[model samples]
Each structure stands twice: as structure tokens, then as C-alpha cells.
Target chain A: MVLDFYFDFASGYSYFAARRIEWLAAAHGAKVRWHPVLLPALTQVTGVLPSPVVPVKWAYVTRDMQRTAQEEAIPFNPSPAFPQMLIAPGRAMLWVRANHGEEVAVSFARTCFQAYYADAVDIADKAVLLGIAEGLGIDGSAFLAGMEDPAIKSQFKEGNERALAQGVFGVPFVIAEGEPFWGYDRFGNLERWLAAARKVA
Target chain B: MVLDFYFDFASGYSYFAARRIEWLAAAHGAKVRWHPVLLPALTQVTGVLPSPVVPVKWAYVTRDMQRTAQEEAIPFNPSPAFPQMLIAPGRAMLWVRANHGEEVAVSFARTCFQAYYADAVDIADKAVLLGIAEGLGIDGSAFLAGMEDPAIKSQFKEGNERALAQGVFGVPFVIAEGEPFWGYDRFGNLERWLAAARKVA
Candidate 1:
């Protein structure tokens, strides 16, 4: 079974899942499909406003995200700006998808998560994006140039609209065999359901 | 330092947390305060209806609860009747608090978690509750009588109201010192915050 891992580079909880999902996917022998989408658009489509729309949930998100990171042994510190602007990283991801295959995009996405959650980097900044590209052995200048392309920018926008069409509302969402699962906490459920389905197949 | 564990007997997540909380609390040199409150009231105040209110969240909850239970080495099975009726259990908690100390109420609350999560018993049924009480060497009839008393019932209602006033939105909602931390995952934060407060003291 293929598990579509829907993530946003700016999301902390996605970092937690991104760190562990590969191992979990291997154990379950499931294929991972990386689906990078904008969280705000997914929320708007579900009629669930951004977490900032609900103060208490937003607080819970930060606290719980930190704890999940700690449990998974992932380094995490909330960005000072918090809920940082995602347009740049979002565009970079689309650029990766266009230039590279799914694997490269997934690797870049995981690197962005580490940069955002562990290094406390401002993901929205172009320099930080260049830094990530350099670390990934991709040409930093080429990546920044790709980020400027209108096609990549439009691809990010279209990804958000597609996510809404798939009925996504939150981060770390997975679509395994047409079934939707949301949040890092639900990854286990997605795994179990996939395993059970494998038995039937 | 004390880690206030806000729980509802009916909540699966709280039950999932209960198995390891004692050990984690001891390791962190923190005291556990078993504060029982109705979850529905907490949800209403936080603008969250219930776990069942969001289908995607509810799906994740069932899978995650089961996996976390296994990972924590706790016995648990997903129930069709999650967000269980707690009218009697809530009152029983308040009765223990009124007549007994917080220690007794907390003990009773943990026992209830075992009854539901580990043993897979129907906690809403009085007979099952009485059976659990008997195992604890308490007079089952007296416990039943106490659970039904009007004053006990009112105290549970008051507990629900107080939880809402405290800005609690989820089970395993924890408060360390004066700072509110929600979810079982935040138990460590509760510990660290208390440790810091102890250092200041």
C-alpha cells in the first residue's frame, strides 16, 4: 500500500512525523508518497480556520508539537516568528518536484522540517532556502532561481487547491489506498489499517 | 512539584496516559494530581465539540490511542463507545474528593482507567463499577450509595464547570504550577515547569 504523506515544511508536527514515518513505513512495508500542500488552504477548504482561529487549539498545537518532538528525540524550538510565512518554502518544494523526482522533493522537505523545527531558521527567508539547498548538494543559486519562477509559484498554489479537493484539513495528512488520515498521531492508525488491508489483499 | 492531571474516566487518551504517568511523575520528581472533569464541558468551552465531532480526528484518535497504549506497554483495545457516559463515574470521583482526600479520588480515577482501557469493561455500568470497588476492598453497596447522592452529583457538575473556567479543552490536560498544559504528551513539560518552579522556590 502507498501512504501519501501530506505535509507542510513550516509545520512542527509534520517534522515529528517526517522523522519517524520512514521507519514506520518500512516496518509496515508501505510505500510513501510525498504530497506537499499548503496547510492554510487545506484548513479553509474544510471550513476549519487556521489553528490561530482557535486560541486554545493553537496553544495545544505548540505544546503538543514540542512534546512529540521530544518523544521522537527530534531537536525542536519554536520559531520566534512562529506560524512563519510559507510562500517561499512552498515554492521551493514545488520547484523540487518539478526539477527532481519525488525522492528529492521528499528529502528537501525533510531538510526544511529540520531547518525550521531544530535550527530555528526563518524558513520564509531566501538565504535559509539557499542554505538548505547547499546542504542537500543541490545548486543553491539554481534553487533560488527556481523559487523565482512563476510556474513553481503557481504549482504551490495548485497543490493547495488539490489538497482541498482531497478533503484535507490538517497537517501530516495521509491518504492510504484512498482513505484519509490526518496528524502525526494518526500515522500509526494509517499504518495499521494498511497492514490489515495487506492481509486481506 | 505537582503535575495536575485533568482527566475524565471516559476519555481513552487519559486512560492511555494513566499507565505510565505514575512512573513518569516519579522519575521527574513530580506529584500527580488526579483532577476529574467532564470532557464534553471542556470541549464546549474550547469550541471543540468532541472527538467524535470530527471524523478525521476521531479516526486518528482510535488508531493512535491503540498504538500509544502498546508503545507504553499498557493494555488497551479500541472501543466503539469512546467518550463514554461518565455521569456516575464523574460523581463517584467528586464523592471520593469530598469524603476522601485527593489521594483517594486519584487512586479511584486510575482504577477506573484500568477497568475501561485494560480490562475492556463497561465503566458506565454500575455492576462493573461495583465489581471494581469490591476488588479494592471497598463496600460495593456503600460506594454505589455515595455515587448516587445528590450532593456528590452536584460536586461533579461543579467540577465540570470549574474545568471550563480553567480553560481546559482536552483530556490529560495538565497544569504545572499556574501554567496550563494540555494533552498527555505535555506531561514532561508539566514536570520541567514544576522543576524550574522548585528551583526558584
Candidate 2:
């Protein structure tokens, strides 16, 4: 079964999951479909206040993300200016997925996540995004054009609607065999479920 | 180092953590302090919306709780009327801790958690709590009186205030070496922290 991995560019935990999911999926011989959705769009549907907006959880998450990153040995240094406008990167990811293949899209998503969370770059800026795309061998100008394409924007919006419809309320949400797992912490549970399903298969 | 476990009687994850924490602490030669807090009070301080109030998250939690409980081999069948008022059980737990020893209070807390989560009994009702106490060989009438004692009620309020001041926004929150780990999923992190602290010691 294919695993649907939903993430938003602004989420640190999503960045953590992005770094590990591919390997985990490979180990289980599972294919992963990365869907980048606009997190703010989900507020109307999920009624979830952004974690950064909630003071106590925000503090806990900041500490937890640092500790978790260190534990996983992943490079993580989130920009102080967090909860950056993810719309541009979100659309860019979908644009790459539509034009270039899934592998290229995955690479693009990872770069955006790393740029924002690990490198502390301003991902919301068009210049920074173009730089990221150009570094990946994708023509900067064309990538910018694609990001602004109405069709690509429509697809991004559709992706958010689809995520809401699929009961996704948070980033790093994983769905396997129609069962939903929310958060990177549930990755272990997802791994077990995948193994169990593989054995049954 | 001692591990401080902050829990709420109505929290399913707290029940999951409650069942395993003592043993986990003992394995590492760590002492555990069980602090039962009123979750609603922390909400006022943290401005975090209750999980159940967020529809999609609430649905995920229902499934996650069941799956986690099964994985942990803990009997869990949440009461149909969940988010039950935890005040009575909260007060009773403090009473047990005040009169009896810490071990007895831990036992009383476990029973209360099991009564609500595993047995699907209404922990909000004083009669049900008294029955649980009587079954545990505690003086049922005296337990009832303690639950209602003005001093005990004041202590319970103090406990909630203490939890708020400590920056507790969720259940199954663990603190060790001044680091806070929230949720049952963070137990692994807590273990690692304990191990590292021991090495330094």
C-alpha cells in the first residue's frame, strides 16, 4: 500500500519527518506520496490554533524539536521568524510535482523544509526560493513562472481541500491502509502498522 | 534525578503513561513524583484548546488511544461520557497522598485511571470514586469525607495552580532535570534524558 505523507513547509516536525520517511518507507518496500498543503487553510476546518500561537505548547515544541532533532542526528536550527508564509513554497512544491516527477518534487520539498528549518533561510521570499530551485538544477525563472501559474495555484488549493476532507488536521500526518497517524511521534506506530500489513500481504 | 509525572484523571494518554512510568523509572534507578493536575486549569493559563474540542484531532485521538492502549497491552475502553469532571478523583488522589504514603497514592491514582479509561466508569461521580477506594481496601467512608474536606479541596486547587505555574499544558507531562516532556510519546525522550543525566552523575 502507498503511504500518503502530508506536510506543511513551516512545520519543524514535518521537517523532521521529511528527513526520515523516505528511508523508512524504503525499508518496508512502501511508496510515499508527499502532499504539501497550506496549514492556514485547515484552520477553518480543524479549528486548531497554530501551535506558535499557543504559548505553552509553543515553548514545549521549541524545546522538543531541538531535543528530537539532536536525538535523530538531523541538522535543525529553525529561524526565529517562524510560521513563515508557506503559501509560496506550498505552491512551488505542487508545481514541481505536476511538471517534474515525484522524485523531483520530493527533492524540492526537502530543500524548502531544510532551508526554513535547518538553514534558517527565509523560504517565503521569492529570491530565496529561486536560489533553492536553481541550486537543485531546476531553471530558476521557469520555476518562478510555474509557482505563479493559476493551474498550479488551483492544484495547491485542491490539495488543502483534499487534506481537510481526509481528516488531516496537522502536519506530518501519515495515512496507511486508510488509517490516519498524526505527528512525527506516531511514526513508530505507523512503522509497526506497515510491518504488520506487509506480513499480512 | 527524579521524574515528575503530571497527569489528569480524565486523560487517556495520562492513563497510558501512568501504567508504565513507575516501572520505567525504577528500571533506571530514578524516583517518580506523581502530580495529578486539573487539565482545565492549565487551559486557562496556556490558552490551548482542549483536544476533544478540535473535531479532527478528537477523532484521531480516539483511534490513537485505542491503538496505543492495545500496543502497550493496557486494557483501555474509554468511557462513553468522556471529559468527565475530574475534580472528585483529583481531590481523592491528593487526599490519599496526604494520609497514606506515596505508594498508596500511586495505587489510588492507577485505580482511578483504570476506573474511567479501562472500566468505563464515571469518575466524576463521588459514589463511583468511593466504590473504587473501598475496593482498594481504603476506608470508603473516610475517603468520602476526605474528598469533601475543605482542606482537601483547597489542596486540589493548589495542585492545579501549581501545574499552571509549572507550564503544564497537557497530560502525561514528565519533567526531569528541569526539562519538560509532554505526552506519552515523549517517554522515550525522558528515558534518554535520564540516561544522560546518570552518566554525568
The per-model lDDT (C-alpha) reads 0.73, 0.86
Docking band of candidate 1? incorrect
- For each candidate, report its DockQ versus the true two-chain complex: 0.17, 0.61
lDDT by residue (tens digit), candidate 1, A1-201? 677778887677777888888877788788787777778777653345566667877776776676566656778875675685477877887788778777787788888877777777778878887887788778877898999998887887888877766767789888877777777766666667767777898
Error of 1 at B49 (Å): 3.2
Cα TM-score per model: 0.71, 0.95
**What lDDT does candidate 1 reach at residue A110?**
81
lDDT (10s digit) by residue, model 2, range B1-201? 688889988888899999889988998898899988888787765555678887788888889998997887889876787966578888898888888878888888888888788888888888888887787788987898898999999998887788777888778899886899999999999888888888988
What candidate 2 gets wrong by more than 4 Å, as runs, is none
The sequence of per-residue lDDT tens digits that candidate 1 reaches over residues B1-201 is 776677878778778667667777787677887777888777764455566666655665676566567656778853445555576776776777676677766677778877777766678888877776667566777888999898787777787777766667778787766677777655556666666666888
Candidate No. with top TM-score: 2
